[model samples]
Target: MTEEIQSKKNQHPADGQQRVVIVGGGLAGLSAATALLGRGVSVDLIESRRQCGGRAASFEDSEDGSLVDACQHVAMGCCTNFLDLCEQTGLGRFLRRDRTLWFIGPDGSRSACTPATWVPAPLHLVPLLFGMNHFSFLEKAALAWGMVRLAVRQKMSDGDTELTAAQWLHSRQPERVIQLFWQPVIESALGESIDLVGISAVRKVVVDGFLAHPKAADLLVPTEPLGEIFGEKLVAWLRGQGVAVHSGRAVTGIQYDESGKATGVVCGQDLVVADAVVLAVPWRAAKRLVPKLLPPVDESFVGSPITAVHLWFDQKIFDLPHAVLVGRVSQWIFQGEEENSVSSEKSCRAPAKEVEHHCQVVISASRGICDGDRNELLETVVNELQEIFPKARGARLMRSRIVTDPTAVLSVRPGIESVRPHATTPVENLFLAGDWTQTGWPSTMEGAVRSGRQAATQLLKMTDMKAECVVKDLHKNAFIRLLVGQ
Candidate 1:
């Protein structure tokens, strides 16, 4: 899918102006733009879509007039980059959630997990160990034991061990626990089956979610529409800062200088010159742009499909936030309160009437989920919901839309440890930034934000931007701690 030209307005740079061209207006690109703008550098952001926000986007249903997210996406309570963006852009208030994750199991069983306390940092691990969702009491104990072992070990040392997540779980966890809990969670996170996902990657997720905090694992789903939250705000902010954001502008090729530096970018018969370029698109997109500039990305990098089944019901059938359904056609279900509230309140308040507000039920982390067998999938989900929520049995189906993206995320396979691209590429002045890149975390919002921040920080070295508040604090804290201790 090549994008057509959306904008050609090129403003001439004033005297002593530093320019940066960012391709792909995803979280990474927008974050980079914000950071660069803060540093007094001019940026030009080109997005392939007419709208901003790459994957973290939202669409509206014309028939029902309800807002629908691209996927049932959320963040962790401990996402540093997301928090930083919120603070920087004054979008913190929108990052609202009840911090409750309800996991529904094979037999219509439901478990709710919430943050136990606010002790800050290290003490956050308590609630998870004692939490009731997803893991069994014994499995939680085993995970705790594994965390202790993982924490004590060295950092930046968990490399390619030719081990699978399933193998790691099998070795460290009981067979029953692996089948019942870890399999679903791992499959969702890594975008691959547990038997294929690398052990180290799984360990990283375990450390971040399980070991980080008692509430760190709490689901932080966005309340507002996704594009409204980050994407649109970013574009408006950039334009306010005199930055050019070109939606539907796609780069077809990159021209290199004699020294192997990025000189210009070609997009639909347009040759845009730039002092620096950031390829913030996905791996496959990057492959199309410049295959020789980076490492040989595995076809496995395209990964598997993640289908989100959005089913609208006449009456509200579920009240739980979201649930994990084991031993069924779906693994996760995200209740769409936003969509439900969009419809008439009278409809929402009514019981199992044929006339009611719309409700969206999301089936997430759907690996082999396809659109061919729509009836089969819907029947399975409806039956399951009937078992869990008795009112769902008679609720009329208003709309059932099945959305699937094959390139949802990079497959973190067992030997895929080497496929992730680094920040710097062979082409100087051209860098890469995406969750799929080596950001330590899984292909998550946190990882995406981290990658963006790192890329911005690196690019800042070429500019004369003042150190950020966080950087200044780091310096101050290091000096103060050294003086006090020494």
Candidate 2:
């Protein structure tokens, strides 16, 4: 397929213009191409998979032949780069913003925690914390204090301490608060257990994700399937803008001249040439291709697992759209809505599908869970839902699936910052972009976009064209600026 398409399109870089070859079709590679739009540089984006969105992709349902997300991906308002890329590509309209975050307590109580829209930066979270029905007044107070302490004082924790989030919380916060609040929140965000995630990551979740701006916590969910939003729409947009998107082609290795400068990539039987290269694949793939260009990835990084439980019932069981489950095997539950039919065939106006009883439960850091027993895990999740929603007890389950990504995210351990490489490599023309890189963010869609844009920026500079592609952080108000000394 790649060879047939390669013969038709002008795959080579046009003469005289600096050409960039992006090696992966994930958010990182896609963003790298988008960043170079109208920059006088030609881009050839090669994606091994047929679809573009890497991890953030969808699968075809076996029964109905429709789209189902491999996992539910959401964006917090703090994800500036991710949101910017989506909006700039006109994919933002497909996003559904949920102002209120629903939290299901241990005792099956529901609380709607919504940050005050008009309130000041730090104070905007006051209503959000106090609204949690699960916590007592004293527990809430302690939780608030702990958040401030983590955000202000301990955010600058010394790298030598090697403190985990669990250790820091347990020392300063009450045990109940640690279990009921910090455990689930931190795990869900970092995709690692609180005991395993570093305190620096937790600080990022609090400060940039929560305290940075009033709108920072707003949740943006895709109304359309991720496959269509990224794999189809975004890809079409990039192609229309003259970016060469070569999908279904696996790049074997990087091509370098004797000077150690990247001249192009080896895709299948073709040596696709370029003046510069953006290696935007995951760490494992990057290390495999250019082993000497990276640090000892075996020691520098580790992956965290995430599981998604897809359940279909005869009738709707969940009353809320989405909720954060406290102290349970199921970390978060999303009540599936009738998804708009943005078919892979490029039917932009097809009739929307009326989905029924279709919902997803996400479990992060699910190592040692049920001892790798799928049946037991499914039973526990179903029973937990039945306990919380009486409707679920009687609803007949039609079908179910358990999807787990063993290495879903980069585990942000203490002292990890030292090993996280920058986009600029010693090879001069070859740049790196991935969520695993040093983007000052977690391994998320946001981090991937930032890394790609940063790589593009550095590459443009190498071509003697100075440009700033990565956008600035969200605007912080005076109070936040003064408090954080930003």
Candidate 3:
């Protein structure tokens, strides 16, 4: 490893070149590297893991030797920064966009939520919500009233950050609306229960995702595994731009000068110096590495857990690519890649008889079953699937694999947002980039990318270089602009 570092040092640009060292090769680090490289700045990205993508990553299935994601990560049309990064990295073509949302109720009733093209911004989902069977007419009316209140409050900047989402909605919405509509969306978006998530985060989700534009709520799922999207394709593009990509290199500590300015990073025994450094790691990792540079993060601002149950069946069970299971243990279900096709660079080729239908059931904010028996959880998911899809009742389970991340996403509690740091830290020439940063967004891929862009832009500004590399948000419609006072 020392020899390899020395070789990279030999290939480093001349002393005058403006080089950056980015620690953590996740979406945030990759985004920073891409932005810097685009501006002819040299970058060295170091990742502790063998592969990148951080939370949005995949691993080999020991049973079938197929690649499976740690958890299913989806994107909404409002995620402009994430989509921009995908397009820049040549991954835009691999995304599968679905405008309609399929909702399956507990008793096997189905409803579809499709936006109306003829309708204007805030009303685009009105027809679909009215037509849905999941909620009663009274419940829909209550939900509409709550949405209007939220929009008005957001426009007026009158939200109470001290309140939880559940507390905010308790008096306005009925129990049915809370369970049938609010909880699922809250869990899916914030990865926390309504009572645990902040009202500000909920407002961001409802406003930016649903009311901002007609297409903002459209969901995009990757047809390929996440490793291929963020690992192979992204790393290749970065390398093509003369960025030094180093994997399995853990940055032990950050180096600073007597003036309290970042100089470089320390990887084990070797120190790789740079003009600037971006610490794009998780909050816990950042606290451990640079405790003095960052503000004290609250101990209560921990992470929420997510669990993915991957199962192979004897035959196809789900007709749709993905669906949300209403009031079920499994929040979302994704139809895995079909047989005879490669899902990733490392996916295994299977024989004809070995080919089977694959499906993944994801449970977000899954604290209830994180420590439960694996077999019991698998059986519960299977039973829930059988309840929803009649075809799944007779399908034999070929194999099962469960993936859990205890610290999947940062818990967006009511007061936790105040603790999230900004892109620019106290240390000069040092920046922070992560999903946990203050990006005016929650902990999503979009937030991660936005933080990266923000950090890179700040670094460039400090160095007196071009700083407008980050993409802007999607334009709001005329009516929405008027409503939100944009």
Q: How well does candidate 1 match the true structure, expressed as C-alpha RMSD?
A: 5.1
* Evaluation by TM-score, superior candidate among 1 and 2: 2
Give lDDT tens digits, candidate 1, residues 1-486: 233222332333565466678888888888777777656666778888888788888777655455577777777655767767776787777665656666666666676656566655344555644565656677778866665554443232345366777666666777766776677777776667776777677766665565554555766767777878767775786778777888876788887778888777787777777777888898888889988866777554655667777777777777776676665667777766653554544434555434444444444345555645778877876777788777788887777777777667777775565767776776667878887888776777666777777677767765545344222111112332332231
Off by over 4 Å in 2: 1-12, 155-159, 340-355
Better of 1 and 2 by lDDT: 2
Identify the runs in model 3 with alpha carbons over 4 angstroms from their true place: 2-4, 10-12, 154-161, 298-300, 339-352
lDDT of 3 by residue, 196-227 (tens): 88787898898898888788889999878898
Q: lDDT: which candidate is best?
A: 2
Each candidate's lDDT (Cα)?
Answer: 0.67, 0.87, 0.83
TM-score of 2: 0.95
Q: What's the C-alpha lDDT at position 432 in model 1? A: 86
Worst 10 residues of 1 by lDDT: 469-478
Q: Tell me, what's the RMSD of every candidate?
A: 5.1, 3.2, 2.5
